[model samples]
Target: MSFVIRNIDKVIVGDGKVLSNADIYVKDGKVSAIGAGLTVPENVEVRYGSGFCAMPGLWDTHCHVQSSGGIWGVDKDMLPEAKAIRAAAQAEPVVLSGTTTLADAGCDGNISFALRDTIAAGIVRGPRLLICGYMIRMTGGRAGKDTEGEVDGPDSARKATRKMIAKGVDFIKLGATGAVSSPGMKQWSPQLTLEEITAACEEAHKAGLKVHSHAYGDEGINLSIRGGADVVVHGITLNDENLQLMKDRSIQLLATLSTYKAKLPYLDKLPRWQAVKHIQVCELLEANFKRAVKAGIDVVAGTDSGMTFNYFGRSSRELDYMVEMGMTPAQAIKTATISAARSFGLDHETGSLAAGKAADILLVRGDPLADIGVLGKAGGVAQVFVAGRLVAAFDECGKEIG
Candidate 1:
């Protein structure tokens, strides 16, 4: 036995099914066995606990960890090297928050890639990252200044997609529409044309990677799905057509409400006009969020954790927002677990507590199925394990912890 977590009160799979009184056995770095009785090797460590619930570790499908930390205290204007240090420090907080896997929605190539490699080598503590080095955008697309790759025509879009593939990106990010945070642009308006979007998607898919579109509104979302994009980053203003498109293509929508959730605190710092516009667009988004959730589509959750006041370790809040939008605790958790894993091509390695999957597990003090909000509280999570190794731990009394 490489490690063993025995005497667990219950084991919850990513899909919300619970296994009672189970012992999860691990060998090397994967779950080797899970049953009622399991014996551990004498030399291997054992973490036995009762009155706790274990499940697959959480996955945040949309995030920008480096840029989020850069805005908080650390100067975003600093050199790349200094910014990297700040970004690396942000990863531990996310891991402690119970997220074992992360997808950087979009970020700088230098910082996010370095963080991804560093985490992979075990040089630092962070989630297994599915990264897009930068977002490919049109000339007047959302996040133009911060976006890494920009193109003008079908040919250019294809080239940009290929370039990111050369850069070793796990997925491609596309700015399919305008954004609320961007000035002179409406959040529900399309930015890139059908030809341009299709070119990028075709190239990305050819290379065996998924394309996540920063899209909103029905038409914009429909174009992305029809163009062959695999995921929509923010389709909060979507309609019935978008739902049909998602179902038809087997695509997923990655909700990023956590960005709007931060607007009030950060609005005072923005220009009054821009701030008001930001609120207006999100009001429309919040209204349609429930409609989309109730449509019975494949939905995943993320914090988009890089804007002002939207820091790391807050991805769990997205789940709460999902529950508020009509999903049950189990369904909301599924969005961040197996659903998210399947969306991003990580289900085989993780997203469930089954044999042959990576031992990415979390032990919580209370039953999330009963009180989902407990998952957002710091003390609710008792332990976090990644690849059969313990990464975080807290005691039941909430005093003694590692």
Candidate 2:
């Protein structure tokens, strides 16, 4: 399919640049050209972009699509088929919210892989999915009861990494610290040792896959950095040394801020231990985030969606938090666009509006450059295209339209 978005008010190039009053020509599921007065074939469809702001589709680096029911309601015992169905149901809302690419942080069994493959095969309507089949953790680590990748020593961790690769995972998710959701575990309790983490990272790197380490405390964060993790997820208790190590290693931070922020209104509904941990983390999040930014760390946007009150389709709110913490509107947008693509090694294909890139484009009603919050507002996203195909279109009232 081929089409052209004519007279776009502005094109956010996703790399801190914008093209004004340009025409975007898309053909064969990729951007053909981006310039004024671009001519197209007679059979191509042309859509008016006069009222819309064009930009690269958003990216969510940390998401759990298979886990739905929130905190107390999350049932780890759900049948595999049921989990897959629920995940499939959640994909549309995510794509419609302007996210064209996302990484499934972890999933039960092989549900994430199935969802990703089905989407690739056109059997499902969703964004591009990169998934880690199950998060590797210590035997008694966080969420051990929910996932199957629990290991103990370096050998065990190496074997677990190989198992995930055999399962055809896109990346390896390592649990370096305990989590807030686990009732018996303290959030700061370091779980995986440096040796174990190194084993897993080495195995994953050898297979040409990135390692995303789930860490919260200083010890875990430092261990992950020393272990050669490609990206550190959460990173709540970052110290100066950790920051220096991360900078020296070129490791990006995927701060899932929305998850902590989303828990505020529902603190009363959470378990006492969980609520306390959430509050503590929320208190430190902004200060630590600002510090990381000031220290010149590369930050990526992720909402930890599908967890507690952090629902899907609200992923763009992470950008608002980023701007509020320190980043400018353009910098925050880059974190979710070009920066995110670079993190996933997808910069060569889709991150921005270029002459030869996947047409993963988002059209919004207002200028996101002036107000980053507009991207999170209702009825803000007017259209969403993935691989040059219009998968979602919303009316002025935020209702889905043909």
Q: Which candidate tops lDDT? A: 2
Tens-digit per-residue lDDT, 284-367, candidate 1: 766677776777678887888876568887678998888877788898889989988887777787898889999999899898
Superposed Cα deviation of residue 127, candidate 1 (Å): 1.4
Kindly list the per-residue Cα lDDT of model 2 for residues 1-72, writing each as its tens digit: 889999999999887779899999999999999988898999989999999999999999889988773775
For each candidate in turn, the TM-score is 0.93, 0.96
The regions of model 1 sitting more than 4 angstroms off are 39-44, 69-76, 143-148, 397-400
TM-score of 2: 0.96
